[model samples]
Each structure stands twice: as structure tokens, then as C-alpha cells.
Target: MTRPVRRTRRALQVAGAVGAALLALSACSSSSGSSGSGSSATSDSSKSSSPKVSGTVTVFAAASLKESFTSLGKEFEKQHPGTKATFNFGGSDTLAASITGGAPADVFAAASPKTMAIVTDKKDAATTPITFVRNQLEIATLPGNPDKVSSLKDLTKSGLKVVLCDKTVPCGAAAQKALDASHLRLTPVSYEQDVKSALTKVELKEADAAVVYRTDVKAAGDKVEGVEFPESAKAINDYPIALLKNAPNAAAAKAFIELVTSAEGQKVLSRAGFLKP
Candidate 1:
């Protein structure tokens, strides 16, 4: 199993992950749900007009989205009394691989369109993936800026012990884009498989800094300090979500997606530092 998958496998809930209930409703004829333009959710068939949702809604989301997604899941549960929202948070690439490998996920929310494409290209998605939110890269340093690191280039200094997400993942790819945009190079002590692991290294003081999503830095609170750079504009990652073609619980999955794209969901994501799509 991929490192991210293993981290949450033991706690995985059944019924796969969450997705668009509306898509399932329009399963036979619907072009409205095929194009993800502007991040607008397709018609909400899981609303009050629809029947109450039951069973579990499994959600496979990116690690950086953990905080906000978790909150939204709880709210989803509260809104639909007997339904449970189970999640498997990890690197977008790993999650995509798992889905394509037949992990039986109902919903997938990836950190980047590239990762989402992995599943879409395989026809694993029931409908076109919708870009829900965007995230920018930020430098995460120990609290109080102990290393006096103020810029992306500063991470290049000798002996800084900076850490980074593996280049195969979204955060790593964005960091690389920012680095290339600034014409700067950094040699991190190690490359983590997910944004959470990279941030954890700095939180534990095992590394001095890491390049991760702004949401991650904010979630860390006092554990780390966030430093924004001008080049991050060149590498913002768009998060996209979709219902799986083989969703075990299509009804609840659609309701979960509806909840994610709802106004309330946007508020939760905004507070977590995600950019408006």
C-alpha cells in the first residue's frame, strides 16, 4: 500500500468515498455535470427535496484538506442524522492511484487537477470532477521564525535542514514551480510523501522548514510560522472532487458532495486558508 493509504487504512469505513448525488440522479442523461467549469456544483439533488440519506459516505481527500474536510464531514453527519462520513486523507497522487486500483471509494477530492485527471482518465469518475478550491505554497518554519528565514531563497542556505514534499505529489510540484519561478534551488533533508508529514517534520523539530500548503501551516497554528512568497502565484494548486463510478452508496455520496460545495462548506474551507475557486 502507498504510505498515505497505510496511514489511514486501519480506520477506513466501508461504502467507499463520497460523490455527487445529482450525478447519480442524472446517470442516464446529464451533460451539466460533465464540465467542471467555475467550480459550481451540479444541480443539488441531495437537498431537502430529496429523500434522507442513510449509510456511510466515504471520502478520500488530500492531506492538506484534512482540517476543513473533517469539519465539513461532521456537519454533513449532523445534517443527515443516520449517515456517517468516513474519510481517508492522504497525498492526492496516492489517493488517485488507490481509486484507480479499485479501492472502492465513493468520493475523491484531490489537491491538484493533475491528480484528479489520473482517475478521470481511467473512467473511474462518475461525472466530470469539479474544482472545489485552490491552495498556494507557503514556507513553514519553526515558531518565532527561529532560523530567520524570510524568503524562499533563504531555504537554500547551507545547513538549514529544510524538508519538502516528494516531487511526485501536489505540494512538491508547486514548490518546484515556485522555486523555478524564482530561479532558486533548495536541497531539503528529505522529501515527504504528503504535506502533513513534511509539516510534521518541522513541528517535531526534526527539520527546520518545509514547503507546504497554506492550509497546513494555518492548521499547525503555533507549531509553525507561515511565510508567504511572491512566487507562489505561479504554483497554486486547484482541488477537484468527484463521485466514483463504482460508488457503493451513491445516495449519501452525492449528499456529501452537495455539502462540500454548499455555501457553508466554502466558509469552512476559507477559514482553513484555502483560496476561493
Candidate 2:
């Protein structure tokens, strides 16, 4: 072969090798770009599934839900950084009244459907209230049931200092239904504004016994003992929760409600002695 011909062929081969290397590099760059775009798509999906939520979520919950709701609220704040879950624990009737009276609340969890209606009727609720759990009435007596108050009628025994929740409250209304179902009539020493208050009376030894929700008795944790009556079945109350119409933080409020109704939240409620709705 001539020198010039050999040199030309050698240069062409080198140039072809360099062009092949560049093509391979181009393919790798294109593949990496496509992979990055897919990763971006995945990130977008994740953000949609867990939309960013922040700010304070004010909740008005029934006194019976203090333990479970508070735990769920903490979980929510943990899941959503830069957020606060505040609660107002009180009688369902009182809470309903407040929600209807233009009180600023993100959520309202009532002890009964009737109390929820108090807000729904006035169009104060942004969403229809859903029952998350059901609560049954129980007679809370001194530790170890000192009074031996097992039956609803036992509260009627002479010299028994029993407390009942105010009739306007869900616990009180349930207690009344159970008492009426058993055809029993007993006068309570006091009518507390909420179930917790009535249970507190027994816990303080100020009252021998009180008619309250089973959850309250469980929350008391040996401070008071629970006595289940068959009549309680006749008076199970359904607890309902809803987002408020004028919630200052609607996005956060909705997210909080979703967490409460989620499986994790239900587990917490179940652990707290609440029944599934």
C-alpha cells in the first residue's frame, strides 16, 4: 500500500472510532434525561397524594373523645410539619351551640347525630357529619365498684349518690333512654354539663356513682369502675364529625378529618375503648 493511502485510511478509522464514542455518550445522556423526567413525574404524583398542608386546625370534640382525638391530632401534626391541631373538649350540645353561634372551628366531632344536626340545620357545617364511632352508656362507680351498682335500677337504691350528665348532652340523653328502657326512675345528685364532669364526680368520691360513657370510665383508668347494663344497648350513641363551613384553615381541617377517619385513627379510637361506627 502507498504511504498516503495508508495514512488516509488510518485517519478515517480514528475519526470513525471517535464518532462511535460520541454516539454512545449521546445515548447515555438521552437515557439519563428520560430517567430524570420519570423521577420528576413520580415526585409530582407523591405531592398530589399528600398535598402540602399547614396552619392551625381547630377542633371541637366531645369530651368522651379527649384521649383518642388528641392522639390522632398529634399524629396529624407529626405527618404535617408546620401545623397545629388544637382541640376544645366539651359537651356535644355545648360544642354544637358554639359552632352554630359563629364560633371559629375547623372541625366538630359530636357525640350524637342529633347534636350534629344542630350545626347541619343551621348550615354551619361544610360537609355532612359522618359517624366515626358509637358509644354506649355505663354506670361509673367507685374503684372496685364499692357500691356494687351493677344494674341501672341499682342507682335508685336508697342513699346512693349518683350523678347524671345534663339531658342536653349526648351522654345524658343516652342515659335517659337506657333508664327509660329499663322502666327505672332515679334522681341524680347532680346533672353535670358533660360526661367527663359526671365521671369526675365519682372519681373525686364526691358521688358514689354516675351514668357516663364506657370510654370515660376506661379513660379514668381505675379511678372509677365501669358496670355495663343491658339497657345500654338500647341507648348507643353515634358520634359524628364534620368540617366547618367557615373554617379559617379549610385545607388543614379537611386533612385532619381525613386522618381521623383513616385506619390509623380508627385504631387509636378502638384502643381507647370506642366502638366502630
Among all candidates shown, the one with the greatest lDDT: 2
lDDT of 2 at 181: 88
Candidate 1: C-alpha lDDT? 0.91
| Model 1 alpha-carbon drift over 4 Å, by segment | 1-49
The residue-by-residue lDDT of candidate 1 on 1-277, one tens digit each, is 5987876774453323333555576773555555643234434533546677899999999999899989999999899898899999999999999999999889999999999999999999998899889999999999999899889999999989999999989999999999999999888899999999999999999999999999999999999999998899999999999999999998888999988899999999999999999
- TM-score per candidate, chains pooled: 0.82, 0.92
Question: Which residue pairs show collisions in model 1?
Answer: 17-58, 17-105, 17-106, 17-107, 18-58, 18-107, 20-254, 21-254
Model 2: worst 10 consecutive residues (lDDT sum)? 144-153
Error of 1 at 129 (Å): 0.6
Q: Residues 1-277, candidate 2, lDDT per residue (tens digit)? A: 6999999999999999999999999999999999999999999999899668999999999999999988898899999999999999999999999989888999999999999999999999999888899988888999988778879889999999999999999999999998888888989999999998999999899999999998888899989889998999999999999999999999999999889899998999999989999
